[model samples]
Target chain A: MLNIENIDVNYGAIRALVQVSLEVNEGEIVALIGANGAGKSTTLRSISGLVKPQSGKIIFEGKEIHNFPPHKVVEIGISQVPEGRRVFPLMTVLENLELGAFSRKDRAGIKEDINNIFLRFPRLEERKQQPAGTLSGGEQQMLAIGRALMSRPKLLLMDEPSMGLAPMLVQEIFNIVKEINQTGTTILLVEQNARMALSIANRAYVLETGSLAMSGSAKELAENEEVQKAYLGH
Target chain B: MLSNFFVQLMNGIALGSTYALIALGYTMVYGIILLINFAHGEIFMSGAFVGLILVTVFHVHIIIAFLGAMLFCMIMGVIIEKIAYKPLRRSTRLAALISAIGVSIFLSNLANLIFGANPTSYPPTKEILFPVKSFELFAGAQVTNLQILIIATSAILMIILQYFIKNTRIGKAMRATSQDYDTAALMGINVNKIISYTFAIGSSLAAAGGVLVGIYFGVVKYNMGTLVGLKAFTAAVLGGIGSIPGAMFGGIALGIGEMFAVAIGLSSYRDAIAFGILIIVLLVKPTGLFGTEIQKKV
Candidate 1:
């Protein structure tokens, strides 16, 4: 489980996130939905240690990790599939995946996990030697997810896993996210696609501007009049 | 005339190998951090001085001195980076560049203070190391043992460097970091450490080039890095600033071009010819020969 308490993040003169808080229970998919500049990605980045919170604390399984650097955050079992699927363009898919487990030392375990990832995504195996940049948008998204999974993370933070994908591919990526959560890893997903995100999430939080606007069970949030009109395009 | 041309070609290669070595440092550091590291030349100068001291004062073996110079410069490069460039990481590129120039001036002046303005010559190769002997290559063309040694050693070092970059885990991490620094950190790569390793490797290569240059030319001076550093920087840019293979090709090509300039009775314009090529490359193909086209992230 993870807990974020009243975290504030700013980018110079702009307050990207203000007093925002969220949590993810073990073995659950938690969705944070917001529009552009709604601080969703900022929230994920703060938790991943890419950006520092000006105030408050982030407790992952009871330890405050707000000040840890990005690499240290990954070392502590939190891996992020960054926004826009920033895979290394020049590196082969296999190399990208290998670097995902950069902090791990278990050679045998790493190898086995890579094989397992290949099994789960056969397209990846077929193009393992190809550079990740050359992959299709959908495939790059898959590679990004696969790369994050390589860290063997306890908490996987995904930022816009479905951005810029075909509708069908978006469905496939969300299905993969659901499948991944079913296998025991906790996921904190940030998405502008509220409908799809709410469909798969166990709990959901809606962010407006830089603060939490609403929070409830995924079903309640999906069916709520305000949530539907504002986020679900109902 | 043909034999003379062949001999010049060999000499050019020996000279170019040193340029390639130094150019690698420029290209690698720029690839990772996008900093030109103007102080890189000073690092080369320091490496030559270190090698000179090891050989003369400490009386170490030539091989040991070579390795020691590399080690010393490796540390020196990292230190310079930490002191001069690292603090300016978040600042403008101009800031870091200015910092680099400052380090360069400080280093060259420090060397001037210690070694004085006089150019120090290495002991005669016959007395301290091995006898210089010329061996015929083919068709009346002759190559010296020193030339062969320089070419062989540079080739070996380059091969090892290529292998290290292409095959090793740290090397892969380095490539990834160069491609995407923040994303690399998301994968748990300590990018700071990677940058340090880059500085170390690049500095070592520059050191090797420095020592080889000193041995070949038999003289090391405080300001030797100025013109040579600019030339190596030219080589890096000419080869494509961030491209590894391009740096090698550019260095050798520039070297041969200079030798040819000399061969054609334009020795005074040799430096001019090198810079002219750089300007032409910049105007014609700014990315250099092997540079990747910049992509807009969607």
Candidate 2:
């Protein structure tokens, strides 16, 4: 489980996140939905230690990890599938996956996990020797997710997994996310696609500008009138 | 005339091998951090001096001296990165570049203070290693044992380097870091360590080059790095700044070109010819021969 308490993030003169707080319980998919510049990504970035919060603390399983560097954060079992699917363009698919487990030392375990990932995403196996950048957008997104899973993180933070995908591909990616959570890994997903996100999430938080606007069960948030109008495009 | 050409070709290769060695340092560092590392030439100079001391003062074996110089420069390179470039990682590219030049100036001047302005020559190869004998290739195209040694040493180092980058885990991590620094961290790679590793590898190669040059040319001067460093920089740019194979090819090509300039009775314009080729390459193909189109993030 993870707890973020009153975290504030700023980009020089601009306040990106102000007194924002959220929580994710074990074995659940938590969705944080917002429009552009709504601080959803900033929230995920803060938790991942890519950006530091000026105030408050982030506790991961009872340890304060607010000041940890990004690599240290990953070492403590938190992995991020960053936005834009920043896979290493020149590296082969297998190499990218190998680097994902950079902090791990179990050779046998790594080999087995890589095989399991290949089984889950057969397209990746077919292109294991090909450079990652040559993959299609949907394939690259799958590779990104696969790369993150390589780290074997207990807490996976996904930022816009469905951005820039075809609608059908988006559905496939969401299905994969649901399948991943069903296997018992806690997921904190940030999305612009609120309808799809809420459909899969057990609990949801709505972000407006740089503050948390609302929080409730996924069903309640989806059916709420103002939430439907602002986020769901109803 | 044909035999004369062949002899010049061999000489060019021996010289180009050194350039190629130094150029690898430039290309690798630039690939990872996007810094030109102007102090690299000074690192080469330091390597030559270190090798000189080991051979003359400490009385070490030639092979031991070569390896020692590399080890010394590897540590030196990492320290330079920590002191000169690491703190400027978040600053502008210009700031890092200026810091590099500052490091370069500091290093060269330090060498000048220590070694003085006079050029020092290596002991005769016959006394230290082996007799310098010219072996005939054909009619009159001859190659010295020293030329063969230099070229073979450079080739072996390059082969080992290529294998290291291609097959090793740390090497793969290095490639990943070069491609995406932050994303690499997200995968649990300590990028700072990777950068240090890069500096270490690059500086070692430059050191190897320095020792080989000191042995081949029989002279090591305090300020030798200035012009040679600039020439190696030219080679890196000519071969495509960030491409590994490109640096090798560019260095050799520049070396041959310089020799050919001398062969064609334009000896005085040799340096001019090197820079002229760089300008032409930039105008014709700014990315150099093997460079991919650099993506600019918005």
TM-score of each: 0.98, 0.98
Q: Compute the lDDT of residue B178 as modeled in candidate 2.
A: 81
Error of 1 at B276 (Å): 1.2
- What lDDT does the true structure give each of the candidates? 0.92, 0.94
Local accuracy of candidate 2 as per-residue lDDT tens digits, A7-27: 999998999999998999999
> Which stretches of model 1 miss by more than 4 angstroms?
B296-298
Fnat for every candidate: 0.98, 0.91
Q: Write the per-residue lDDT of candidate 1 for residues A82-105, one digit (tens) a residue.
A: 999999988999998899999999
Across B1-298, the per-residue lDDT of candidate 1 in tens digits comes to 8999999999899999899999999999999999999999999999999999999999999899999999999999999889989999989899999999999999999999999999999877876669999998788899999989988988899999899999998899889888888889899999899999999999999999999999999999999998899999999999999888999998898899999999999999999999999899999999999998756453
Q: What DockQ does predicted model 2 obtain?
A: 0.89
Model 2, position B225, has a per-residue lDDT of 92
Task: Report the interface RMSD that candidate 2 achieves against the true structure, in angstroms.
Answer: 0.7
The first chain of model 1 has a TM-score of 0.99
User: DockQ values for all predictions?
Assistant: 0.92, 0.89
Report the lDDT tens digits of candidate 2 across residue range B111-137.
Answer: 999999999989889877899999997
